[model samples]
Target: MKRSVIPREFFCRYTPEVASDLVGCRLVRVIRGRRISGIVVETEAYRGPKDPASHAYRGKTSRNGVMFGPPGHAYVYFTMGMHFCLNVTTEPTGTPGAVLLRAIEPEEGIAVMVKNRGPIAVDRLASGPGNLTKALGIGKELDGEDLVMSDRIFLEHGRMAREIGTSPRVGVSAGRSTRWRFFERGNRFVSRGRPSSPQNP
Candidate 1:
């Protein structure tokens, strides 16, 4: 069976509603003659300008302008003096929203990922957003790339062997009321930084 490249083709239908479903999916990178795969374990949703924590909250600028573009685009950004994070642009052409890829568990090309992240263990090579981006060689140059068609970075489907967990996002003082972080339930690779929801995390 030729599965669609984007397992969640209609992912934009609900804005941040189903961003959690992205957990457990695989993100593939074909870089420099090597193919690497990572199992998505953590994610966060940025709900348009109204949400204070969103980068697009201040309106579209050259930095976040891509988020205003159509869905399926990569709206990656750099932060904390030296870290790059990946986000899947969401909503319509004029809406600025996205789902943040917080962490992943490397499955393929582990050696390459380790090389990128330095002598880290295969399991901890891409445990957090910064760590994962570092392990994947994802940087500002790859910003604005289209997730649906990018040869360097893309996503795949799998029968995730765990439950989908829910929680509030981490590292943001604002928009704390909205529970926008999601992860693979019981997955050891999941981020431990976020606060768990009463229902689950």
Candidate 2:
């Protein structure tokens, strides 16, 4: 079947809208000549300076500069000094916004994902942001990559999720009350993470 790559226009909109719409899309990563892919099952929207939990909330930095770039780009970041998380830039240029890819249902390369994630269950291979990156071989080196143009990493059209659930983002303190997290209900590949507690005054 011919692949339908998602267009940049799809991401040049409100961050929350893009985040919700991203559920069920296919995220593909090509490492060497092998293709690894999965159906996006969970996402979290971070609305730039307006979202205190966002990396761009404090203004653009070298690490978050990709968030302020054109839409449909990868904004991969290293976190906890150990893992990498993948995000897709949203909104127009100068507008800092992104949709963090929280989880995915592994698709194209199961054996490779198993090798990458060790002896984990298939459903848990890409069940969280960090593991999703690891399963697909995503890292900081792919940061700022133009998803619309890059053959190495890109998104493709997939069946739209039938039941999408929304809740506050996970592991965030300041934006704990915002229902920006979107996930496919009943998806085993979705992360089971709960929201972090609100920050102290």
Candidate 3:
């Protein structure tokens, strides 16, 4: 079951579109010849500079400049001054849009993931953005890495989710009105299992 890497064109769409479509895709990280991967189960979209919850909403800066570049790049950022969160840049070049990879269902390198996130239930290993990044060894050094071509990390095409759920994004002080969070219906790995109305991208 060798999956093909998802192409850059897949991420060139609107951030919400990319976020919704990203469910069930594979998020992979390669370290020292070992591959750790998971099925993307949750995502939150941050629309361009207008979306106040987005880091780019305030316009590009030294930290968020990568998000304004071409789509299909990694947008890793340190949050809460302690943990890292991973996002994928989206939209046309110069547009500041991205999809936060909120959660994933572990598929490979379970041993490594367990090592990073010790003594946790398997499904809980990557149940949140910070947890997922820690399990997959993603950090600030991976910021701006091109996902379309990076050998260390990249997305792979996986089975599309037959059912998807949508709801307002979690943990955002602003842009709470935007129902841009998406997750695989009934996926236990999702950070928040509660489902609202389904959205069609």
Candidate 4:
């Protein structure tokens, strides 16, 4: 199938609801001589200030300042002393809210993903936050870069992805009352289901 690249206009138009609804879209990253694409199997939503699950809750800092920038940008960050996670800036410029890409099922460029991720089963690679970023070669350098024009990464319009499911976000202490995260049900690529809420569905 031809890649369904998302246009900058569509990306810029995204709201927190739209971002949350992007769970099953395909995420594609063009690497050295390879095009790695995957069905975005999981996602999380963070509303600024009001949503305790958001990084902007602490207000914009040197690390999270990019969240204050324009939409269609990448927001990569490190955590757990060794892992790097990825997020996409949402809402308009100066407004802070984001959609966290939680998981993806490896589709194209399995060999490339394997090369970046070291030895792992094809299905296991790019299955979690850290692994997905590693497999796609995403790092702090791409942190504030615009995904709409980035030569290496961009989002595609996978209309079928709307069939995706929703649950509360993972590893969050706040915003535990509402269901905000999204994922593809039954897809092994879904990262561990340690949600902030008591239920998974």
- lDDT per residue, candidate 3, 1-201, as tens digits? 755999899999988999999998999999998999999999999976678898887787899998889999999989988889999999899888999999999999999999999988998999989999999999889999999889999999877797988888888889978889998888888885334533333
Best by lDDT: 2
Count of backbone collisions in candidate 4: 0
Tens digits of per-residue lDDT for model 2, 21-120: 9998999999888889989999999987779999999998999999999999999999999999999999999999999999999889899999998997
lDDT of 4 at 33: 58
The models' CA-based lDDT, in order, is 0.79, 0.91, 0.89, 0.77
Stretches of candidate 1 exceeding 4 Å from the true structure = 1-3, 194-201
Tens-place lDDT per residue, model 1, 1-201, is 775468335556555664776776788888887888887888889967689998889887899998888888888799999999988888778877788888888788988887888895666788778888888888988888888877788887745647777766788999989878887777777667734534352
Model 3 RMSD vs true structure: 3.1
Question: What is the TM-score of each predicted model, taking all chains together?
Answer: 0.91, 0.94, 0.93, 0.88
lDDT of 1 at 8: 34
For residues 77-147, what per-residue lDDT tens digits would candidate 4 score against the true structure? 99988778888878878888778887888889888888889998877798778888988888887888788
Report lDDT (Cα) of residue 3, candidate 4.
45
- Provide the RMSD of all predictions against the true structure, rounded to 1 decimal: 2.4, 3.6, 3.1, 2.7
